[model samples]
Target: MDVPALLDWFDETARDLPWRAAGTTGWGVLVSEVMLQQTPVARVAPIWQEWMARWPKPSDLAAATQGEVLRAWGKLGYPRRALRLHAAASAIADDHGDVVPADVDTLLGLPGVGAYTARAVAAFAYGQRCPVVDTNVRRVVARAVHGAGDAGPPSTTKDMADVAALLPEDAAAAAKASAALMELGAVVCVARGPRCADCPVFDGCAWQRNGRPAYAGPAKAVQKFAGTDRQVRGLLLDVLRDTDEPATKARLDRVWSDAGQRDRCLDSLLVDGLVEQTPDGRFALPGEHGAVSPRG
Candidate 1:
């Protein structure tokens, strides 16, 4: 593999992400990882910047109320990630000496820190050599190494092994290469359409050499948001986020017409610790039953 060529391409084309900048703290990297899960970087950037500016460290976030955390998360899609991140911040401040742990295993112990995220933080944040395989990295490896048109069903063990084997001997170089692989997949080698001409490792790409055959596997399911419980949940949360007063049943009902589905979604949020019932039986963001949170 032309490792230097790949790294050079990355150096030239990589997005100037704040987390990737020099001197970004481990906590900053951790926040970015959690926010970026199943969410696009473009939507995550402003929220991440404001978040880092407000809660510069785990301790800073830990000191914040659950309502404050939820309010700050604001439409990042998966609101549960905000709750998990808050839990992680609490753990870091209380147990880990307010330092984001550098070890992969230790990082995995934190809330919302999965294998890919742990490896990413270890490699990108701490400059350790580790295989950081996400959907993008997995797709890049499938085409570039195995000649497959698409990655197989999520296989962490096999995917990690494939990525680790391709790592350079030098730790820093391996980290750069890992980032490059994900970047290539994200931009040039996109799933639906690959710009092979711009790919840095086009010469060694197995799928390209094999004539870019169509994937014959079963079609992946397309997620629908419109009329789903998630939409109802979002609507309910939106009502709460917009006002200091707890949302009465009639007010919350305005978002969705179906009473059963709306109630189910609200119940789920309450159970998830994202929303709570006020003494007067109105709904509000957790820990913000009557008071408005300061938004920065």
Candidate 2:
């Protein structure tokens, strides 16, 4: 697929991401991978920079409390990831002596490090030749190579095989190719509407030739934000994030109109280890300390 041409393009055009700096620490790569999940690069860039500057290594993050990580997470949704990342840092510090694991299997054992993240850390941080397929790369492969309108749900085995087949034998070149493919997907082969003219694969794109047929499968589920438990959780967490002290149950109740949903969301947060309750029956983010409250 003119692999050298693609790699050359990536060498010249790849965005100057901080995580991609020469000899970037493995912990920095791990942070970037987690932050980029389902989040825009524009938003991730600044936050990633701030995070690395604040905690340059896994040991640094491990020393910080979970509350500190959640607070640093800011507007990034899916706060659970922040908690998991903090846990991962702690694990790295305790088990791996604060060094990010170079092996894919070992990285996978870390909290919140999934198949994609594992491969990304191995390839990007250690310069290993591994298939690193995310949503963007999946879409690009689906349309350009398979002639499909969109990628099916992520199944690492199939996706990785397809991407690996396209890689050059040299480890360094393979990593560069992977990045090129991802770049093509992100900027040119976008999901809602692709910029075909600007795409490097336009010449060989099967979906373009087929008139971009619409998928006949069931419609993608639309996530409802209003009145959902997730919305309630967001409201509840927002109050806690803004406050220095733990919030009373009564204070949290005011955020959600439905008592049942609010209680459910709060309970879910507690179950997920994201929030802790004080003895006085106030809730705060995990790691916020207070004396045990006596029974009412």
lDDT for each residue of candidate 2 in 45-115, tens digit (9 for 90 to 100): 89898898999988898888888889899878889999889989999999998999999999999889999
| Leading candidate by lDDT | 1
Give all TM-scores, in the order shown: 0.95, 0.94
Q: State each model's CA lDDT, in order.
A: 0.88, 0.86
Give candidate 2's error at residue 126 in angstroms.
Answer: 0.7
How many residue pairs clash in all the candidates, one count each?
0, 2
Error of 2 at 202 (Å): 1.7
Q: Give me the candidate number with maximum TM-score.
A: 1
- What is the lDDT, from 0 to 100, of the residue 292 in candidate 1? 35
What are the clashing pairs of model 2? 279-293, 280-293
Model 1: CA > 4 A from native: 290-296
* Residue 17 displacement (Å), model 2: 2.0
Q: In model 2, where is the ten-residue run with the lowest total lDDT?
A: 287-296
